[model samples]
Target: MTIKLLAIGKTDHTDLQSLIDDYQKRLGFYVKFEFEIIPDLKKTKNLSEDQQKQKEGELILGKLNSTDVMIVLDENGKQLDSVNFSQYLQKHMNSGIKQLVFVIGGPYGFSPEVYQKANGKLSLSKMTFSHQMIRLFMIEQLYRGFTILKNEPYHHR
Candidate 1:
């Protein structure tokens, strides 16, 4: 399956962008991967948290196709170890899906509509992480998962 990571806003830090780029390149060797950045909402200061989430949810949902399997990254979601995450990826690939979409929502998190649309939710850690940094971390974990699947030396037990 083609894997796509959709995140709101562009990463402003050069260091984090470099790391994300590296992992994206490495992931290409294993699977079809795409990173799409949805531009941040404008004048969000005027809107309530719920309103902002609603707007962002519309944008997030707009990117998806009916057949795409949507997965949202949320703080309260299920956390998996590296091995199990690899197995998770394998499970999706074996399911014959055309695209598997993983989304990192805005500052206030996903709206109820977005959450409802997702096939599943995953959490990287219990501790909070910045939206920009999470992109790098997520890509690295994806790279690691693929390496584990390929019996490559990138991940060590």
Candidate 2:
């Protein structure tokens, strides 16, 4: 199965992008991983929070194929540790799905429509994180999860 990460906006910080790239390369050894950035909405200062979410939701939903299983990275979603997350990845692989898409929404978070289309929701932490930082965190976790699954020395546990 292919694991895809879709997030809103590009990472402006070079340091963060470099780290994300490194993990992405490491992940390629274990699985086909794709990181896609959805461009930020224009004239956001003119739109209301709900309006922005609605527009962003459209862009997010447009990226998916009919068979893709979308899981949104939501603040109120389920949180799992590295080991459990590895098992979660294993479960999805065993289920024989084509693509597993995890989305990171814009500033106001996902819209009702986006939430409704999601197969599941996952949270990296109870505390909030910047969208750019979340990209790195998510990618690094994916790499860590694969290492755990392979019994690699990368993960201490």
Candidate 3:
């Protein structure tokens, strides 16, 4: 299955960008991977939390294709270890999905529509992490999962 990461706004850290790029390139060898950025809303001070979420939800849902299997990277979502995460990837591939989309929502998190569209949710960690940092972490985990699947030296138990 082709894997896609849909996150709100661009990452400002050049260092993080390079690291994410490195893992993305490495992951290409195992499976198709793509990262798409949804531009941040211009003004939010006047908007209610619900309104902000609704607007961003529209943009997030717009990126999806009907056949896509969406998974959200949510704080309260199911958390899995490296081996388990790799197994999860294998299971999705076995299911014959066209695309596996994982969304990292905006600052306030996902709206009802976005939540409804999601097939499942995954938590990388119990501790909170900055959205910018999550990009690097997600890509690195993806790379690690692939290496584990392939029995490569890139990752060890």
Candidate 4:
């Protein structure tokens, strides 16, 4: 299955963007992976938190295809270890899915409509992380999961 990571805004930090690119390149060896950044919303000063979320939700939803499996990355979502995450990937691949999309929401988190569209939710960690940082972390974890699945030395047990 092809894996797509949809995140709100760009990673402005040079260091983080470099790492994200590295992982994306590495993941290419294992599977088709796409890292897409939805441009940040402007004029947020006049919009309420819910309003921002609603707008972001629309953009997120527009990126998805009807047949795609959408999973939102939320702090309150189910937490899984590296091994289990690999198994999760394996399960999806075995199911003959064409595309699996994982989304990282904007600052206020996903709107109710976005949640309704999601097939599931996953939490990378209990502690809060900047959206930029989470982009790197998520990609690295995906690379690690693929390595673990292949018994590569890149990931040590």
Candidate 5:
């Protein structure tokens, strides 16, 4: 299955962007991985939190194909270790799905509609992280997962 990461807004920090690019390039070697950023909503100071989530939900939903499986990277989601995450990916690939899309929501989190659309949710950690920082962490974890699958030297026991 093709893997795609959809996140709200750009990574403005050059350091984070560089690391994202590097891991993305390495990830491509193991699978068809795509990293996409959805533009952040503007003038959020005027909009209520719910309103912002609704708008962001629409944009997030717009990026999805009907056949795609959307898994949100959420704090309350089921947490997996590196090894299990790799097997989880293998299970999806074996199922012959066309695309697997993982989404990182805005700071306020998902709207009801977006939650309805998701096939599942995954948590990297129970601890909270900045939405921007999560982007980098997600990418790196993906890379490490692939390496673990291949018995590569990147991640030590």
Candidate 6:
């Protein structure tokens, strides 16, 4: 199964992008991984929060395939520890899905339509994080999960 991460906006911080790139490369050794950035909306200062989310949601939804299982990274979603998250990844792989897509929405979060289309929601933490930072965290967790599955020394258990 291919794991794809779709997030809004580009990472402006070189340090964060470098870390994200490293993890993405590490994850490639275990499974096919794709990280896609949806460009931020233009003239956001003129649009309402709902409108921005609606527009961003359209861009997010457009990137999916019909067979993709999408999961949104939402603040109020289910939170799992490292081991449990590895199990989660294993479960999906066993299910024989084509692509597992996880999305990190814009500042206003996901639109109602986007939420409705999602197969599930997952939260990295109860505390909020910047959208850019979440990209690195998610990628690293994916790498860590794969290491755990492989019984590697990367994850300390």
| TM-score of each candidate structure, all chains considered together | 0.98, 0.98, 0.97, 0.98, 0.97, 0.98
Screening candidate 4 with a backbone cut-off below 3 angstroms (N, C-alpha, C), the clashing residue pairs are none
Candidates in descending lDDT order: 2, 1, 6, 4, 3, 5
Instruction: State the TM-score for model 2.
Output: 0.98
In candidate 1, how many Å is residue 46 off? 0.8
Residue 35 CA displacement from its true place in model 1, Å: 0.1
Can you give the lDDT of residue 143 in candidate 6?
96
Cα lDDT tens digits, model 2, 1-157, are 9999999999999999999999999999999999999999999999999999999999999999999999999999999999999999999999999999999999999999999999999999999999999999999999999999999999995
Q: Which portions of model 3 show Cα errors greater than 4 Å?
A: none
Cα lDDT of candidate 2 equals 0.97
Which residue pairs in candidate 5 collide?
Answer: none
Q: What is candidate 6's lDDT per residue for 38-137, written digit by digit as tens?
A: 9989899899999999999999999999999999999999999999999999999999999999999999999999999999999999998999999999
Pairs with steric clashes in candidate 3: none
Which 10 consecutive positions of candidate 6 have the poorest summed lDDT? 148-157
Candidate 4 local lDDT, residue 47: 99
Model 1 per-residue lDDT tens digits across residues 1-157: 8999999999999988999999999899999999999999999889999999999999999999999999999999999999899999999999999999999999999999999999999999999999999999899999999999999988985
- Give the lowest summed-lDDT range of ten residues in model 2: 148-157
